[model samples]
Target: MWRSLWRSIDRFSPQYFKYILNELRGIKVVERSNRELVIDILQSMVEIVTYGDKHDPIIFEYFMEYQVMAEFVRVLKISKNSRIEAPLLQYLSIMIQNIESDHAIYYCFSNGYINSIITHPFKFEGGDLASYYMSFLRAVSSKLNRDTLCLLVKVELVS
Candidate 1:
């Protein structure tokens, strides 16, 4: 049943992604009103985007046009209390790891979005958070190559 549903993705629409992105953007991280909802939305967004990357580049591009990567970073920064950090990292890692296309990977790694999240001073005291953090790092590391190197490092003129 699950595989059938997963494979029957022709009905999936970009409007679904846009609606979820709107919900994600509206979520107030500090307020505990919709914590579980936020996590669920993150998982859905990642799943949709990952599947779209492999099945339909147009759907993935539509999601990216909304600046989802940068929004994820903003959510991570505001979610300093670790309420949703672990799951966010886990989903992010999963998403990044599943990106198969070089163009899609470049879109994710571009604009220093991933760099900001990686270098952010996240409170990694808990085992789960630390583990997911490392997982996220490993996922990002796997995507690194000569083309994506510029996204992570800056070359300043010293002269």
Candidate 2:
């Protein structure tokens, strides 16, 4: 199910992609009043953030500027009421905090090739992509304190 959704996203036209983003943005804004919808939106956002775009300089620049983080924060605030069932809020919080740290920028550059796959998976010939992303996360993890790491996982399991 998830794979199909991702594949559809992969094939989306730029206008369609923008439309999806805009709709998600609106849903994110009203998420506080709609827990179930928020959960779906967050899951979609995670897919996009994790697998949607990694190579485009524009996406990289947008991430660097933290606009994505800001939008995530908006969703976090709305979803706080559903925190018991929403571990993503915690994951996102940690991501925002760590983005300011050196590890994020380092990983960003070092993982450029993998990032490229995320942005344009159609271009990926073949590789252990899971390990690549995992290693990138591990590299980021090494830079964080144990407490923060625990908090991130706890967020994942909370709901």
Candidate 3:
């Protein structure tokens, strides 16, 4: 469905891509009877966020929107016991890096989004899962371009 939508969109209009991406991102949060389908959709959305064309500001803006942030956080929160956890974390980390590379402001916004999501009241049950998330954040923070990191940190601290 999403592939067909993407193919149908006029590539010249970034807004069309943004609309499709937002809808796919929302699927990650929907309660579905078929868990496999949900996982597949989430995986596809992550891949789009990570590797889709960087020339589109609408794509980047869609990612920065709160709905996409919520879906990403929900995935990180709920996928702890699944076999896909490691790969999902890796994909998320790459997505974070891609967003950061494209816009420094988004780096700070996403970091805050992650921080808020993880620090919620419920206890996360899996030690390995928690460690993977922490490691991803640490890796991203360490490897971020120095100037971008400075800007991210400043915005994160202030906001």
Candidate 4:
């Protein structure tokens, strides 16, 4: 059954995945008022990352090569609205949590990409959005080691 599922998944050619990813990348989340589209995009991203295994680097490589994280960061940078930022942040949080490779995780943390998501500098109105950020922080803190603890401390203090 698992092999059959894998075979079914394999039928999605690399070109097809690229086309879908390109379309997803093209979405302007900050400018669009369509809430459904935002959900769809984020959900699609979640599904992609979900399919990956902890030892599998293929999906992770594709994400890095395609610069999907950059797009999420771009949305956060250009938009002050939490409604827009929350989903993007959640997408990033999932990425942080599910990432299997130390190299990928290190790049995200060291380069300040994950920091930006954590310390968003934007105010959330109802405390709802703040909770989401807090959840992400907790997950990250739990996963921290001695080296990353220092960086996490600095980021938490600054945030």
Alpha-carbon runs more than 4 Å astray in model 1: 1-11, 80-82
lDDT of 3 at 134: 74
Candidates arranged by lDDT, highest first: 1, 4, 3, 2
Question: Mind giving the per-residue lDDT tens digits that candidate 3 earns over 34-129?
Answer: 345555655665555554435555555565664566665666565433544555566666655555354633453545655654354433475566
lDDT of each: 0.83, 0.44, 0.55, 0.63
Q: Which candidate is the best by TM-score?
A: 1
| Cα-based lDDT at residue 51, candidate 4 | 54
Better of 1 and 2 by lDDT: 1
Q: For residues 1-159, write the lDDT of model 1, one tens digit per residue.
A: 778767644335687888889888986663466777888888988998998989877778886788899888878877745477888889999999998998889889888888898888877674667888899999999998899988788979798
Better of 1 and 4 by lDDT: 1
Shift of residue 152 alpha carbon in model 2, Å: 16
Name the regions of candidate 4 deviating beyond 4 angstroms.
Answer: 1-17, 53-56, 80-82, 147-159
The TM-scores, one per candidate, come to 0.87, 0.41, 0.53, 0.70
Any residue pairs clashing in model 4, and if so which?
none
Taking all chains together, the TM-score of candidate 2 against the true structure is: 0.41
Instruction: List, residue by residue over 1-159, the lDDT tens digit for candidate 4.
Output: 778766544423344446657766676655556655665666666556545435445765676677766666776676535367667666666767876666666555665666667766867777577877877787677668876655545544554
